[model samples]
Target: MNILNIDLYSILIAYIGIALILAKIMGSLFEKYRLPAVLGEILTGVFLGSSFISIFSPSLSWFYKDPEFHYPLEHIGHIGILLLLFISGLETDVRTLKKTGKVATISTVMGVITPFILGYIAGILMGYSNQTSMVLGALLTATSIGVTARTMMDLGVLSSDVGTASLSASVMDDFLGIIAIILAIGASSIISLAIVGVNMLLLIVLELMVGMLVIKYIMRAMEKIKTTKAILGMSFGLMLLFAAFSQMTVQAAIEGAFFAGIIIGTTAESKIINDDVKAIAYGFFIPMFFVYIGSLINLQVFTNMKAIILAVVIVIIAIVGKVIGRAVGAKMGGFNWKQSLQMGIGSIPRMEVALVSIMIAIKGGAVKGELADIFLAATMIFVTVTTLITPPLLKWSFKDEIQQNGG
Candidate 1:
């Protein structure tokens, strides 16, 4: 285990150890300043990542240079994201979502449509090809439920009316964003659209009917085992299985983890496993996921004038589109101005799905080499800016409520 000649396993072990320790330290520091711990976790990655190291300490860049190192870290981060979604699902109150369902649905529709149209038009105005413009629009349509859910939970508002609606709406946003991706990639045939629609319907049926019944009984049997470790292990395994199934069918594994959590939330075991699940998720996986996201951002993108301008335009349109669209929809659905604004802010952050859409566009040959690089750079900036801004804005938007409740 020579440090200089470290193998893959050794490198991975060292990386995880460093990541967890730094993440915990930064997360706590951010919390002390009343900022979201997620922001600190992400910043830790930025500081340790190639973006910083390549400029300040080129010798240290070798740690992330190997493809072997990159791929394993990415998969581990993916698991963190799935676990975050699973915990979000488990905490989701079905009754609250049901009460806010109409608002959520309406807001999600408007939220998706507005940003998509704006992004497409912005791309065209920026002189990108039609295909690239469609991809841009598709990117704007994403709402990162992981960021939203984590921030909401940190604020202790995850079960509130606005929180429930925002969470539900974010889920629908991701699904619709998938459809946008299909269109962007020139797969908008009737057959493709039908398949997506069917998948959505299937997810609904599975969550509400078949999946619920099956998981309920399984938990009941597991409960009979009478051991906390057994229950935790069973729950974690089911979450992974559900995530895999969901990825195979709907192309979104987090959705599967989410639906699984919702099902498990209804069981008596939910209470027993809640704290343990949080300990596992927050202690390791979730922070790593945020850090991985930060690492993906290459600050060098800002060096290109064209890319910087494009990112600025895209960021403005992305924020304005979501805020206006969701606010209008929320108002139409009977919310006050403040709550509508809160929903708008809640839906602003875009992460994994946006990046995926752009990659699909580039790899599918819709965007050419130089343009693809530009688009990717602009997208990374967009994701980073949107993510960094959301937590603070969302907390401020709910300020009056927090004060009223003495939170």
Candidate 2:
């Protein structure tokens, strides 16, 4: 076989095999240490990707050098993200979400505004151009719903008040962040913010209309499927279709997968579907997604002191800003200080949503040159730190409750 026509199938097979094995080993090890399994998966990626790959296995440099292998693995990892969110959507208690709706809204709004303002100020104070500052602000506004959701599930609090509020707030957090990203990018481009705002509103309306129509059709079709295998197949197909559609029309495919799960969750068979989704997702897809997130981290920019300082400042603002904002919002919503703080801590992780926006801003020249690399590295660091912190904070926050339950 010619070098130009390398065996894509073998590469993919090897990648999956390696990813799954590492994810399982690391995931189990983390669980053994009383840490979140996803953390281990992500660490595995960090150990293998841009950060530490060359140190351990220079021969494997071809993995990242070849776009053919890299891009497909990324796509597969993205599928994992979609499946995780879809499963989350399936398990989401809509009634609980509605009960916490007002608080979730308030928390999400504060979560977006405070971090954004703080990030913008920090950037400007650091002498970055206003355009770059605004993009930095936009990046700070993201809340990684999947990461937080996983933590809540791991802690067995996904259905609790703080957990539900966190999940609900994340939806709003992602929504507002998406809008901010559009505005920030628009400020740098020929397009006016007003035009971008209008386009965003239109996109939301269109997504809602199309999502509802497709979901309804899927629900009815699912009713006709009798066998377990057929139902599972139908469920997976619908999830993939909706996820792809969401990517095409919206900011993220997970958004569509989530809503698709919500639609299926309304059916009598939803519990069965949820279990099935969980089995496949946790076993493979979701772990791959987190590991892929780690793989994207490049610490090469850390050598720049200015970038490092800016990154540290931004991380501080990101962490403190979210805690203060969401804690206040949670307090206003009648949560006790413990629950409120839990909510704040839960809001801290920023992953795919922020990353996608940052990548776009970099490509669009909103954040230029070495600054972009530095910012990217910083975001990855804090996201990892936040992910590491949440589970332990959550356990601490629920100590009394857990003790009372005799755990």
Candidate 3:
């Protein structure tokens, strides 16, 4: 496997080079057609990986199947995932979140409750066991804030009123979704719920009190040491610290990254920090993350009749439950139909969180045999379908607003 006498490691370089070149090419094509560039990046994954290539081009199958080629690519993509959320947080307006906290909380609760109940009922109707039904319900409660955030960013609305509301509500969704998954797995007692509640309380206190104090201190320190490079180093280290703390002990790492961003965002060097971070994240990491997400799809699921049906049903319930539920909550909080629709459309995609719940169920013995396979297939499809639909819906919902604002 020597390429110009460079050994197999040169293969890694070639793989990354090809992926980046194809990603940018496809991303540009999608943008030209007035769609999110990420759609193209994901489609690039679908084309290059097993979904299409492994099946269609078995002769070239070694390219994707060789772990030597794929694993490192996947690892790079995972890092992209972290940076994407970190930047999202950096751009967040905490004050806007504070003003809409009650509404967002209400939206999160309704968002989780409806999908959970509907998914549970769907599972029961399909003759699945009680524990399986619980797992299904729990899986339904997840919201992939990253997916939604990417689409919103593509639309240039990532920090808009609806965007902030969606982000804040999704943070709550991820929290509740994780708790539901743990409960469904039957791994923890009621005490686990109490601990989660306390964690939530602590997160709020930390955000309002500790977060402010720390950011205030960081801002003052930055003013004294005024190099953009040093500020970036400190800010990035802080974001990673928060992300690690959240994942190891409390909330979702994405939420922690967002909070970390907020902290750095408050400082005068925010713009400089943002430009540098964007160069790194958007340039290399985030695109790989989207491609990695796309590559995970097993198109073989399309061959299973039961799995296809299950995917359709779960996806429908997922869409209706999140949209109608969140919309209802938004209306109650004083938003009109238009705004409610925008918020609902923005919050419907479920990715990593839902996958985690489904995986937990499989490992815990709640879903097994043919049922486990079907559930996994269905969940992957559900996430894909939901991810596909969000961008257009958001564009439709926000078209008037964007037009009125004059591009």
TM-score of each: 0.75, 0.74, 0.71
Q: Considering every candidate listed, which one attains the maximal TM-score? A: 1
Q: What is the lDDT of residue 70 in candidate 2?
A: 80
Q: Which residue pairs of candidate 1 clash? A: none
**Candidate 1 — which residues are off by over 4 angstroms?**
1-8, 101-105, 124-135, 138-191, 226-228, 334-380, 383-407
Better-scoring candidate (lDDT), 1 or 2: 1
Model 1, residue 318: distance off in Å is 1.8
- Badly placed stretches (over 4 Å) of model 3 are 1-6, 56-68, 101-109, 120-194, 200-211, 219-228, 334-380, 383-407
Better of 2 and 3 by lDDT: 3
Whole-model alpha-carbon lDDT for candidate 2? 0.74
Model 1 scores what on Cα lDDT?
Answer: 0.79
lDDT of 2 at 33: 73
Residues 347-401, candidate 3, lDDT per residue (tens digit)? 7888767765665466457777778768877887788789878888888888886
Q: Which pairs clash in model 3?
A: 89-258
The full ranking of all candidates by TM-score, starting with the best, is 1, 2, 3
Clashes of each: 0, 0, 1
- Measured by lDDT, the strongest candidate is 1
